[model samples]
Target: MRPICLPERVAARAFPPLAPIAFACSLALQLSPARAQNALSVEPDTTAGSVPLRVLDARVRLGGERVRLPGRENMGLAGLTELLNVGGEWWVGPGVYGAATGHRGGLFVPGVEGAWSHPFNDWLAVDTGVFAGGGGGAAAPVGGGLMLRPHVDLVFRFPGFYTGPTFSKVWFTSGQINSNQFGWMLNVDSSFRYRPADFHGTATDGSATGLGFDHVDATVTMARPRNSTSTAGTPMTQRIGLVGLRAERSVDGPFWAGIEAAGAGSGGVAGYAEVLGTAGLRFPVVGDRLSLGVRGAVGLGGGGAIDTGGGLLVKASAGMTLRLTDTLGIGAELGLVDAPDGHYKAETAAVSLNWALDVPQRDLSDWFNTRPGTPTRMEFGTGVERYRAARKDGRTEALEAVVLQVNRFVAPDVYLTGQAHSAFAGGAGAYSVGLFGIGAQMPVSQRVRLGAEALAGAAGGGGVDTQGGAVLQARAYADVALTDSLSLRVAAGKIKSVHGGLDAPVVDAALVFSFGVDHKH
Candidate 1:
């Protein structure tokens, strides 16, 4: 998802209706000048000549509406430290963030962030940074975050070309009322972005908001090839290529707005479309040190060969970066995306602590290691399980059952497993059972893997018994990364049973094939 950015002028325009109410309250305060004076006396002095100090600033935001999550309320906190250079052009700071459901605070996350700034010749300067942290308020333990952003600007001194640095600064100088009166004050002078290849963070503003940078904008992404099937059970294979373009304007001040269009090709799915409008705002958090801001977009026109029945697509987010020392700091974000038919409705909150080392600009391969050709891997597995049937009266004796298994992974983290079982009894005829199972795997470590499964089959007399279970399996036997697409696993654990089985002791092993999304931490 992208952060939502509002233009200074637009933000200024949005203030009028709400300003009267606030101004009236401000006037009531005038009645107590003595109290106001006393308040000022106790307030921390933020003067240009004060000694540099760390200021702790945090925000708790709660937003709930009919949109997005339907009837759910979303809330989060941005805890940060703003390093002020009370007297210089360079500033830096870092902090952490966490968000959760409004009803329950049980699911909580903590993440880190950092930012830095150096003014060059007053009119031009460059800013660059990164972040890595995690925990979605909903799945705190498994959540993660990471981001990298570096940007430069050519400041135009004249109002004719560039807008002022902040909305507050611009409005104070021109004395012109605008829609988003406080819009500029809430921005950091940098772009909001993430690396898409790793799925470590959400898409960049261009991809999320359908906005562009400069007059010409381009984007491209490629994932390792694989194969899978749709929910409708259609077989599909994929060789990835994701690309797009758009038109953008470098607005004055810490803001920009544009329009964009992009397309993706993978498996049997292909689609393209144009975004309506997108905008962003960036400004320093405290002086030239820490930075924070928002960026967002809404769909406008163009529906392509693969339309998800588009009505509206929107993206919004808020982020902060802090500079800890020179090479390390923390960053965090709260983002959301909503598209037609719930195709793009995802609320994501993440934080990261990152350490970056300056590397000379080099070819793509210098940054990423890749094999000259595709690698082929194979795996074979088998396991035995026992199910002790419940004992009845004297007429029947307890039954002991055993199963044989086999599985294979056709792609990364995907598998197909098969099992056969036979039952032996002291008082009845020996009966047999068969099962075919399919599932997905997520590896957390060398000996731990998390997975969900669905299976269907019949027992003695062809009595049907279908089951589904979520497995948190651990390999008690071995530890090794077998291959890019294959993992050697030996696990034993209880699964959340979804079917009725007579106290089945699930002790079985088989080769497994897995596929689908990878949630990385």
Candidate 2:
């Protein structure tokens, strides 16, 4: 069969509008944004140079459930989990691979996951994997609290599309008061990889090569004309060298699009990765196995790269691809690039290795999983606390203190908390007072939360009327969540000095930032 190129007029109509949400949450998980470009380096069982490692396989998921815990009523929690892991993997068989990633959410979950992908034929496949993690937390006082997830994927290989069902079990902890707490959830995601060969004029199946593929190429800029003419009036060819990775999706027709982020900063240029969005057309020449295309894009050029006011950029290019096999291929392109306010421009050319990411060619080695997220909400703040009272001998005092608070979502509208404060002002000067206690918080709205606590720790610093004595404190406050982990607070409380026999009042405010996750439901 021969691959055909669509007429320019017809190609323009090939793309149809898709829903906006269609752009997000396409898979239960995506190995990586550039999974295919990195596929060739992965091997099923090769002692290859230092085994492959995956660093920070970050994943984000939406949807949750409400469950009942021992001694507690049913709590409906908005399910949101953030994980970071460092691990290695090995291929088990023709359609199977296993990997372990250290996971952390509200609790510590570290486990292994395996996938078995069996091709129904060359165009379809079935894939399944089970993921598990175990670790210790406040609830899992002894053994590790665990998490298990099993998923199934139905894949359309030719188009590189996959979708399926996923089920998961998230555990809390095992403690003396009760035993354990956990939740169950189910969700679905779908997405497709760009198949360069599938686009109009890209190429046909079982080809030696194809046009329109994701690739990593090395480029050499042979000529860069300067604003001022040379003595001889000929443009000098500097021949600057560079390398980069390009991911594209021309899945629909002759037009393909994707992001290109590559780096080159050696030889006095300042390291920078040129990232751009591209769209283009393909023309088939010999049969359906080889084709040529032209692409145009505009984006910012940063990383010290020469750019005008805002680092504006534009690139016009022509390229060709030849498939050596069903999955392996080669490509080269010549481009006219202008950046940094169009002050810098060059005529560039380069070659690339086109590798398509698919089940049959996937090899997992030194891959990693890590990322930062607010798994729980903890705040650190600063405020001024004061006290006032009546009594012939009762004294009033004011102090500036540093406050630290930790909280967790317990119910839709409530939170459990622990707080501490160390005073640096007031009559005691430096060695003043310290307050610590447990309390509760309630969110009155998306941004505001009301709270109260009682604390008693140590009191007294150097002074004629001083000696260390027990300090008692209590307060009520209102805090507003500023971001995923930040907040601002206003509070009022009472303090009593046991040794000085005085009653004090506290009035203060603070800026707080949470270090972990907060109530989402």
Candidate 3:
């Protein structure tokens, strides 16, 4: 069997936690009121019946854990997460964890977690939560890639943030790894602001909300390993293909900062992935239609038999872009990848399509008067999905996962969406996927609506056969409104590999929360 490892740096954890937590917190603080207040509670206390959904809070945290490889090899993992305070002292968000020590190079996990914070006094607090996700690449034994972590932290509160030590357990339920470890965490507090889901289709004075990011890019990248070494002390010859997404905001004229994530989709290197924090600058070369730029990134990655010693990585690149429209562009770049703690090096090239969103720039002085721009319609929710017999080795068991989805309506009946899924059952742990596309829906009854969506993106790991890592799926779904802001959604679809033999039927159920923001563009 090929030595399992992970991919290069694009996004996710390390360094006692992921850096994006701090990065994301800073962005939120820029859009928050200047007054000092508790980060855990942004809204006044109210019963759940009075408000279904609203802006909760902004938080950032870091953690660490220890794990065991086969043959008694040991490794340490650093984890980081950024969360949205959703009221009731609860937080929900995404996080990344990667091997920070020992011999494991591409060991990483990216997944979602929900946490609850309780205050014991004005100066002390406690946090308890669980994380669910998947990943495993290099010689790591995260069988099926499913991982569960339950942790607690005791923290000391300051004016705007809190720090403390944490204790937790790491369990790969269907795999060959389980351990208990100690770590640390940090949480930042910020202002709260959000309109209810009932306002999803109404107009509001354009204000900045969410991360307040100004640009996004969808990219396809190719990396050619150059004189790379495997864990077994042999030369690596596989050229890897990747799919990625990046979200960015301008910090100054011609300069920007962003976060990105990518996964292997080709080259038979499934289970390889990366998450990175990036900074770059762009200068106009041909007026506003063309530009040239350079960027640098740092984060954790490993897996796919590639030696990423301790899963710490950094990259530098230079490139150019051509504007295709006011909101879209095409770009290309050349870069070099290096692992400071491992034996991995590569020459990389990529092509990307970019979008400029209409939102407030990264201005820190305009928080008190800002009102977030509203969309015509929007839906955010979580659900569960299952894939029937989708494994590459011809297994018959069904693969089940937890999914998160966001849908935005561009027209009255047409919408665009993005989704992420992490497998938790069917022995397919550590398998994750990201997808984006468009859909259309229409109301068919007083309380019901029907819709269909076509999506394409990248998937890998957990022994699933997503050839070259690219996949296409289409789903038809029905929605029954439970409240103005809440609904029940059920969908059925088929997912097919664009380059391999895995074809399967899929079904899912979700609790969707709908809201609208007014966009003044």
What are the per-residue Cα lDDT tens digits for candidate 3 across 1-521?
A: 67433211212222333354435435443433322223335663422323322455677565555565668787878777777777778988777777776777666666789999899899999999999876655546667677899998887898778877677888887778788766655566653344564442323443324444567788888999887887777887888888888777666678777777777778766666777778788999998889999998877776655677777778899999998765568999999998887888899999999866543222123222233334446677688889875667866578887777877665567777877776677776656777888899889997899999999887766677776678888999999999877899999999888887668899999989776433333
What's the TM-score of each model vs. the native?
Answer: 0.21, 0.30, 0.82
Per-residue accuracy of model 2 over 161-200 as CA lDDT, tens digit each: 3323223333322322122232222222222221211112
lDDT of 1 by residue, 111-207 (tens): 2223344546545543322322221212112211121112222232331112222211111011111111122112222211111111222211111
- Using lDDT as the measure, the top candidate is 3
The C-alpha stretches of model 2 lying farther than 4 A from their native spots are 1-225, 228-238, 340-342, 359-521
Candidate achieving the largest TM-score: 3
| Cα lDDT computed for each candidate against the true fold | 0.31, 0.39, 0.71
- Minimal lDDT window, size 10, model 1: 169-178
Candidate 2 accuracy as lDDT: 0.39
